[model samples]
Target: MYRLTTHSAIAEIPAEHWNRLADPDTPFLHHAFLDAMERHGCVGESLGWLPHHLALRDGDDRILAVAPAYLKFNSYGEFVFDWSWADAYRRHGRAYYPKLIVASPYTPATGPRILTGATPQRRDIARVLIQGAVQVAEKLGVSSLHWLFTADDETDWLAEQGSMRRLGCQFHWRNPGYGSFDDFLGAFTAAKRKQIKRERRRVAENGIRIRRVRGDAVTESEWAIFHRLYRDTFDKRGGLPTLTLPFFQDIGERMGRNLLLVLAYHDRNIVAAAFNLIGERSLYGRHWGCFQDFHSLHFDACYYQGLEYCIEQGLTRFEPGAQGEHKVSRGFLPTATWSAHWIANADFRQAIARFLDTETRDMQDYLAEMNTHSPYRADALPDRIQAVS
Candidate 1:
């Protein structure tokens, strides 16, 4: 028999135990990353991200499966945008603030939601974790339960258990054993390849030098500069910069091997930087900021640098955060992202089910449309798509 338990903090579970079940390819799901958010005050009730992680324990109290979860009071950080659903609930004189979600707070990259090892009973353990999460939602009397940016297989598992599957899309670059950036670009059509080269040249023409630095190699002063850029950018854009400096510092110390910072320099000073997490098989682009805006600098610092790094590092994929169709033209292809929802209210559930069905069709059509505009040469298209898949 297995027992389900919820902890208000990730620290209640040991890091080794938690990470043993996590996919090494997903840095966001690492114990150090999630714990840093909690320890650095990035997530809390005040921030609408209260950590209420779920764990399934065996008879001897050993954790067999785990899911990083939260009781959200608002729809601020989760990228799966459920504001419309929340608004609908509000219009109906119902509450949607305290919804339960299984996700890495403020992260939209797809990975394991129900974490389990390669044991024979992995599937069984995942099922229990899902059911346990639902039971917790019911006991808490929350409006709904959501698993955001979940792995394709886990999303399927959630749907098998009656959760509503929501389809979304992200532009990701896949490395098909390219030896270098130039080699990778060779797959692109001549026009698109020239466009990409022009964009990279713009950064050089502006006297901006870009470099990729590992977390451990980054000095304290450098981190401060990057944090400043991050905050200033968010301020200018009128978005909240929730991840604190301390959080970045802590993660830099604890998970340095998994962290990558892309810095752009002009005049021997730091002007912009992109923060990313490096996984065993993937590189995840997270945040970016620039003190000086140079033409095409954002593309170079964020997307191009990430792509180059992935190619050099032998990483198979690069997920440069979420929702930028322009990335598609830059050799990144549209890939399907998913989320699963379980609404407690029967009426709302049925309504959401219908809405998702329509939305799913729309998403399907959108992905198909996006594919027709692939930047790769006709002869290279087959291999490129297969690599991404």
Candidate 2:
């Protein structure tokens, strides 16, 4: 038997039980990560991300599966970009706020959505959890439901359930069995190679030095400065900071080694910083902020610094956040991202389906054009990578 309930807090669910459902390889899905978000007040009713997490319990009252869900009043931090869809609903005199979102708050990296036990009944558990979302959407009379930045398995199952699928692209760097940073750079074309070298040189010439400190090396004072940078970066753009300083400090203290902080200093004064999360095989470049905008500083701090770290650490992939064609020129390759949605209204559902069909094809074409301008040599491109566009 399966039971459903709205979780008031992530702590309401035991950490051990939640961790059991998550893959040990992906730390972002772990209980500590979600708990830190809520515990630090980064997510909750006040932040417009009310936790309505779903769980499947067995007859023995053991947690079998789970999904991180939220009741969203507006879509801001979600990189999946659904504002136009919301606007269309309003144009047609429909209410679009208060939609149910099953995703990681303020995170766009794809990972498992449905966490089930490794037993014969696992598939059924996933189905039931998905059905729970649909039922809840209907009961609440929300405009739609969305499962953003989900892994391939979740997308496949949701598609089978007739959910409208959408495709977006992000640039990610993959290690191609390179032994060192130099070896990795050798794969790039001659001109692009020289360009990267110049950019790194510019950072050094500007009296700025970059350092990578992980885990315990990140002090509270460093986090406070980084938080200010993060807030200023968002505030300057006329938006509110989605995360709190305490949240960063908490994650750094608890998941220190997994936390990679790239700091840029000028004359021993920190001017900019980028915070990244290191998973088992991938590095997620999530946030960055700088007090001053030095030439080529953003690229050096965000892209070059992260890529070099990945190569040195022998990590498999580096996903430096979302939406940057400029990253492609610096050796990041185009990769397709998936998000699945279920609109409660039939008319809106059909309309979105029609839009997605055309959008997917256009995205494919855009990626194809991007490939022709890749920084890598033709011989270095693997068959699988070549077929991405």
Question: What lDDT would each prediction earn against the true structure?
Answer: 0.91, 0.84
lDDT for predicted candidate 2 compared with the true structure = 0.84
lDDT for each residue of candidate 1 in 1-389, tens digit (9 for 90 to 100)? 88999999999999999999999998899999999999999999789999999989989999999999999999998999989999999999999879999999888898888889768887778988888889999999999999999888888889999899999999888777889999988988999999999999989999999889999999999999999999998899999999999999999999999999999999999999999999999999999998888999999989999988888889998999999989988988889899999999999999999999899899889998888789988887646574323
TM-scores, all candidates, are 0.98, 0.95
Give the clashing pairs for model 2.
215-256
Q: Per-residue alpha-carbon lDDT of model 2 for 36-134, expressed as tens digits? A: 999888887778898888887767887889888888998977888888999998999998899999888888887788877456776778887888778
Cα lDDT for residue 247, model 2?
85
Judged by lDDT, which candidate is best?
A: 1
What candidate 1 gets wrong by more than 4 Å, as runs, is 382-389
- Superposed by TM-score, candidate 1 places the C-alpha of residue 50 at a distance from the truth, in angstroms, of 0.7
lDDT of model 2 at position 49: 90
Model 2 clash count equals 1
Query: What TM-score does prediction 2 earn?
Result: 0.95
Ten consecutive residues with minimal summed lDDT in candidate 2?
380-389
